[model samples]
Target chain A: MTINPKAKLEETQDGTVVYNFDPLIVKSHYEIDYVHSYAQDSEFFKALGRQELMGSKCKKCGYTYGTPRGHCMECGSETEWYKLPNEGKIHAFTTCYFGGEAFLNETPFHLVLVEFEGVDSLFMSRIIGVDTEDLYVGMPIRAKFRRNLKLNPTDVYFVPKA
Target chain B: MKNKGQDVYMISGGVTKFTKASPEADFRLRTKKAFDYALNDVGMTLKDIDGSVASYFSDHFQRQLMSGIMAQDYLGLTPKPSKRVEGGGATGGLSFQAGVEEVASGRMNTCVVYGFETMSHVNTWKGNEFIALASDTNFDYPIGGFYTGYYAMMATRHMHEFGTTVEQLAKVSVKNHGNALHNPYAQSPMKITVEDVRKSPMVSYPLTRLDVCAMSDGAAVAVLANEEKAFELCDNPVLIKGIGTGTDTMRLSDRPHGKVILLPNETEADYKNLKYPGVHSFRAGRSAAKEAYQSAGITDPLEELDIVELHDAYTSSEIQTYEDLGLCKYGEGGHFVEEGKADLKGKVAVNPSGGLLACGHPVGATGIMQAVFMFWQLQRTIKKHFKDDALQISNAKRGLIHSHAGTGTYVTATIMEAVK
Candidate 1:
């Protein structure tokens, strides 16, 4: 006679560990990695590895976006790559003592919005090699590219122009 | 926003106590509790709610997709048409507007808007990362663009251009936290002085730890209905007079400089030389407020509105919104706060419920919390809710509620009046 298949069961019938019991709370873990193309804006990150700062210029509005956009903000129009100057002036800045998990260990860092000459908008990056007290708006700053690029925005930062 | 549609009224509202972690109940149960309390307040039941709009900032915190559906099921609101809204910090405000539209459009006679958030799901640091995801993931997030960092930079520019001082920013913390002392549901109520705020540990420059709102877990509910049903449902009905929504580019730097959008109260010469909506100002907030006022038939907000419940994610932004909402001219917010213009006794009481700063910002729940507070304030029921008359805006007739997201991306300005 053929025996019926049996379903397997855990040795312990207890469920996942309950962190709390008043309302029955349990731990739920989640994490994931994302792989997505930068698409039209890929050129900006590539230019950083080549020691070049690239932005986008709207073909219709002639608005040069320093932050590099795929389209213009004033008038919705496709944009093209436009090379940016290495040196710019600080438009706004802050010294952060607290940050996200990715940058928490690197606390007390300066973030600046750099405005290039003739460029209508600003670009943001970290400012190293200067004290918080010394950083000021209108301070001349220049971009510094990493020799080893991680293909990330942090690959390019700013330093006070000597 | 005209009166072409049926007039909508906020019948009743309720909220759960705000806390860092709610061990007594999960997100869905918290919402149900708020819903039950709201229904009880008006002597109604779930059967009275025609539909619902759910608001929560992120699904990552709850770790549950279709959280709104789960909440609907738990609240016994299933099989009724329902939807969820996610708009960073503005989710609650957007959800309120969504429910109002339901009744206004003749689609439903009554609609319930509920919002909740469990920010304590992950560790504080991981939660910061989750909040940071609201920024452009590739451009801004990659450079460690924390929300605090963005506001700090903006606050710094405001200081540079307008001579705004850290002391002025500190006073905002003192004002908001002090106001929270009267709010039972407030998270970080303190009788803090400017010195205490200045001494608080720094999160970002010019913004001390006390200047920032702590993330928390909470839920709030607002029941809305048409004019006919409003009177039948409640004794003191508050009309939803006007609604406006505005948005800016996701990237802060992409914002283009333009002429100042004139509010009904201001003249062009008042800001002829100023470069509008710089990092120092929120252009989207101005746009939203302007539209709200236009629809509400308001000529001047500071003079007409009795109170304002605005998003104060940071102390500095509270000052910025004062200017955006036409309470004061641009570059005058710092002085306005220093002069005690935002106090309960001021021309128009601001954040009588302690706002996001002291009320505890639970992402999606914050805006609805503001609405709940406003509804109580307008209904002259503040003493009923707080058990004390210490926080009521005396003779409050009209008020405004502002919800903002990101640096200045999405903002909604909604005006409400106590309809006689």
Candidate 2:
């Protein structure tokens, strides 16, 4: 095979030459358009803005969902929004050393699944204010909401309860 | 039991060598190679195939869509009933199941099921993002939780609940890597100690870089035929005794955790320590295995099944799958591995093909590759290619193939036996 005469060649630190016939690198960025409507639990984030954790309780089955649901998954009944206790215990947790591009700056972050005293489902959020070694399952934690935040679950965090 | 349906058998299968990098090959070339290999294995050609099932997880990598048509056109198999299948990592097995059903239903006498992924063409960051697409975008992605973190959480929970140690988890990687040393198709076959695994850089806590399977480029294809056609066309065949598939909630938060306890006499502490059944166990795997065992009439898998090929994408997954597939009792997976029950010389040899952990995970190709490995083992033709005597299980009559997709959302379990 004949090599391209116009090929660009570059030398590496190890003295190895790399050839690139097509030096033009096309860069593109695209976004996935999605309409996220929190109609079921718009109040959930609104409550988080006020530093209060909230959940939905199924009036029919008495099942409480940590992340607010519009209807009961069990009986298909309308759910009632209720303020959840800020205090909960860690159901499970993991300390991530390598966070992807989105979370690269916040390396060594702790992601915990906190189960409230009465909630049926676990609430997953980042945990702060504790040594990584000290964090254990069933450790008491309290919700801490981010100030000046928009409608997102990451707006809330948990810390070791005093 | 009532009459199930027509019997289906895997007459032949083929797989390209798993590699971390294959810059020269693309999806079409890999598919054609795997297809031709499978056809040659059975002494057939494209003209003999009546139907085809192709699986490739994301067209984004290839910048193409309608992969089934693409494969069909590239293979020059015109007018053949061809379709695509996708179920995250379980796409290959799901495609195989579809092919089996197509033949069993008498719609097609012979069919080809194949899957491939050319992930090495893309950069690692882009590949990681593409893989994250399989997760629940609304919940998992926003929380900075991808596959590694998701599995790490499960590992942590398993450690807490069952006292499973990180060393025990490392033993899985050690054992799989040791098995891969004998596999010619494996990507990384170097043997390492449990201490090496623990010393490896932590991607997510409790799970190091070595614990996760490498992203690979490869393709695997299998030919399925009805009983009569299999008996007529091939001298020896691997019968597909049973196939089962099940799914769980898409989002991790919505996974079933059993019923909520409510009693007036219960203390707050009791509720705090309330243990749910489905936390560590993969419900989808359990459900699929249950159906498979029932259909195959297998009461004791550890005792009845001679060999197994499980989806060991992460070392933790393999440990958990031991419990999910009923190879051992719940919360005994760590002990199962510690006792050497899952070794090649153990009660039930698991992942004799080096598994995804050592052989490299090409996503769509993994499940089909497992079936290909099982087919070779049962047909006793594995030694021809692998040339590893220790890799072959002794008197292997029955084998099982299990694969899970998208954080336990989908599972496919297939039981295959050697036709005496």
Candidate 3:
């Protein structure tokens, strides 16, 4: 978790100093990791494994969330898991040409904000089986799940529901 | 003038030249320069400041913490109340508001609010990742919803709903950059056309590279005091007539997404319920502007306010803010800009300091920089400091500063009036 304080620095013609760190040394000294808990929505992903789109609805206000949550933000009521229809529409979308390391191989991919019929909030997912130029708002879409569920949101995507 | 007992005045303001990077300068150097400049502007020293608030988004670059204490120690101002404030990109405005509260509440007679950012130490990608830390990692990051993508989605939705065009968004950049031509402290002052913005490399769909604000390294400071001390310390003080802050949901998905357009004959209630989609920061800005205008007794912002400095992190944001701040009706942002209404010579001058589009956005410094621009503009001292007369808004008596941070989650709006 420490970088070398004495790393060699090189000055470029533009008067910018570039620090050169030994990758081996740097990697040996530090490790980046991610940790999380899914105690609230373990069932949500398990349902996704069966190609079922499940959401949570507040008992008080009947507000439905696309991404299942333990509590409803609007009514502060505990939510009950419910099955959502696979069909939805593209509320908004963008084709991102740049991303982090995890998405480097998926550069220039289309990310769509999809709104299920009667859903209160929108959820984001990648759009597959559709041409980028053909994407437009209000275009009908349907949830497309991966063969195997990894308990990650990326396990589900959307495509043109023709 | 309407808010009697709750008045806060800005005695002086200062800023370091915004640039792509400042490898040679660290927090200590940047804070010292900005602090000294602020003191010099008011002909006062550190001894005159009773409290201080420092704002910096991250210490990763400097590997330092307790920026307020460090700033106080660096300036040799000890045993004084000091604190640090951070609200992502709105850090400066929040810090400034803290200083205003400190003095206005009688806890301190005079206070200084300073904001700095040194992001050049890391590579561009790493820096972008650091910026992305502002988003909800569980949902946004995994889906590639970084700042550019977040705004790009909003832009796309705005275009889809309001028929806003790419050229209309480009006009914001063109106008701001043209304004920056007269600002020496701006990072990019080149004259660019709407076509140039359309041709720029795409970062996210509908958001070309030129549409985004430049990541910059800079620092800014403003000195605030109660009405009595303000008049005693400075000859031309800018009265802080009103201040407001608001927030929305951190996760973009939690908010409304589909388009909500308002008809021409719609009522305020109808516009509120119909036009706002809840995804953009317009709701937060509306809440903040409501509080600010109420305190300032500003019934009409487009008429009463002489100038405005919006947080144009991207071109689309500025256009959206116009509608959010009620400078124009909903969905008229694109036409407002295309018709030259937001220009320097237009009805209400916006981002006369070039805004973040051309002035550069150094995270923490941006809010204070906007305030500093307004301070100078209201004081009519732009020619004296920037040595440029064209950028000055003639007879600018009142101005407003709007800044937002996170994914449109935090917003701060302030109304300032010239008081000689």
In TM-score terms, candidate 3 sits at 0.91
Of 1 and 2, which scores higher on TM-score?
A: 1
Give per-residue CA lDDT, model 3, range B1-420, as digits (tens): 243455789989889999997767676788789888889877997678897888888765444667667777887777788888999888888888888888877888898888888877666656676777788665567766677888888888888877899999999999999999999999998799999999999988899988999888899989999878888999999999999887888776778543433222235663553535555436677777877887888877888989999999999999988987778877789999999999999999999999999989888889999999999999999999899799899999999999899767888999999986
**Cα error of candidate 3 at position B407, Å:** 2.5
The DockQ scores of all candidates, in the order shown, are: 0.76, 0.34, 0.35
**Segments of candidate 2 deviating more than 4 angstroms:** A1-41, A76-78, B1-3, B259-276
Best by lDDT: 1
Q: Give per-residue CA lDDT, model 1, range B24-56, as digits (tens).
A: 788899998888888999998878889989989
Predicted model with the maximum DockQ: 1
Worst 10 residues of 2 chain B by lDDT: B259-268
The digit string of per-residue lDDT tens for model 2 on B86-166 reads 999888889889888899889999998888887775666567667777775544667777778778888888898889999
The CAPRI classification for model 2 reads as acceptable
Chain B TM-score, model 2, reads 0.94
